[model samples]
Target: MLAQLRQQAILERVRRTGGVRVAELVRDLGVSDMTIRRDLEALADRGLVEKVHGGATIVGAGSTEEPGFTAKSARQQAEKEAIARHAARLVRPGSSVALSAGTTTWTFAHHLADVPELTVITNSLKVADVFHRAGRPDQTVVLVGGVRTPSDALVGPVAVAAIRSMNVDMLILGVHGMSVKAGFTTPNLLEAETDRELVGAAQRLVVLADHTKWGTIGISTIARLEQADVVVSDTGLSGEARAALSEHVGELVLADPGADEREAPAP
Candidate 1:
């Protein structure tokens, strides 16, 4: 496999199991031991993992580590796409919307890029680019300006100030993690602040996340589960997760990545 793809696979394994031994990666990937070490080193340099004597562990076991956009976008590809499709159905044409930064929200942006007379306000450059590429004349995109995070989100005071003045029909949020206690969270403090601003600007909040995000906690809490008008995730979510989210969120929607444009039956 190419180095990028190989690294992504290794990263996924580590994230899934919380760590991976070099021997295991070499045996599973069919790469040299030295190659495995190099990949581990690369991931470590990006703060995505912590290199140890014989293996690597996911960075920020405390949930403060922030992965770059490229690394995050490679994961849960099918799940993100599925969640995006289901979330898109909630939007109506010509309505103003706010999209928070994250891979899932970026995927959701593509599904809405061509909606007629829609106005989009966002802190994610990636989401803005999706609309730009669609070249829809009737769409207006407002790219909030601020310092960019590892996740390609514009945050800090400038972004927050811009969002506070506007009101949207709905806000599509993508979070780093979600739990019954922590609700929705992100590792970056500034990004969390900006996201809170986005939340306040919208009449309704819809969060898009894959099942892997469950139980993962970030350093900062963006909002509680009850703040969400809807939470959309994949069928991969655990039954416990569905029950908790269903109780707190206004609605819990599950998408089936394996099915063609179908939502998983609600719990």
Candidate 2:
């Protein structure tokens, strides 16, 4: 149909240019102003674009592939916080956990401050700074040394080597995308390689991702779906996604931003 073609063209333009104005859409798609508005609204509903003052921006736009920290931090604040709170419950006091880099992972670090007598290891300077500012002496923090990525993650051979030497109780991983085939993936190859090392060093792997990550494919995969012990995601996930993930992961915890209790298997 004409609407479908217009939608595809709009999406392609947004992906190529990072964003598009309503006026621009009207001009480019040769559609009316009302039609362009409807298309944008539909795209925003699907989590593909974010509506702003004059127009919409692709949700995750950049040559970097991953959204910048500030942009990502603002996109799904409530959902990430809810996911982090639920993930924090999985970590008990006096346990060692490895937290990966990303805005979602950073939110998890914030929720973790209340947890006492925990050792947290990470290659994220931002995460380290947050914990340092909180000053939880009862918690021991390990900052992995390596080359920093555009997203502020420490990666490369040095980081991978350091991560391989330590064993942790749990690994809370974050990624750019998650597909049945790709499992868990990142845009940066070095970061993906480092993630693999972290996965190998932990007894349990818990993935922290929002619903938008579903069905997307990134540059490199770190682990298979079956390799994850648990996956913590927002309730925005589709029914098909929930079923697909449940088949491979031991537990799929769905956190509703508006609710206190999360939906998960009754263990």
Per-candidate RMSD, Å: 7.5, 8.4
Error of 2 at 238 (Å): 0.3
TM-score of 2: 0.76
Per TM-score, the best of the predicted structures is: 1
Relative to the true structure, candidate 1 reaches a TM of 0.78
Positional deviation of residue 113's Cα in model 2 after best superposition, in angstroms: 0.7
List where candidate 1 sits over 4 angstroms from the true fold: 1-61, 261-267
lDDT of model number 1: 0.90
What lDDT is reached at residue 230 by model 2? 95
lDDT of candidate 1 at residue 243, scale 0 to 100: 93
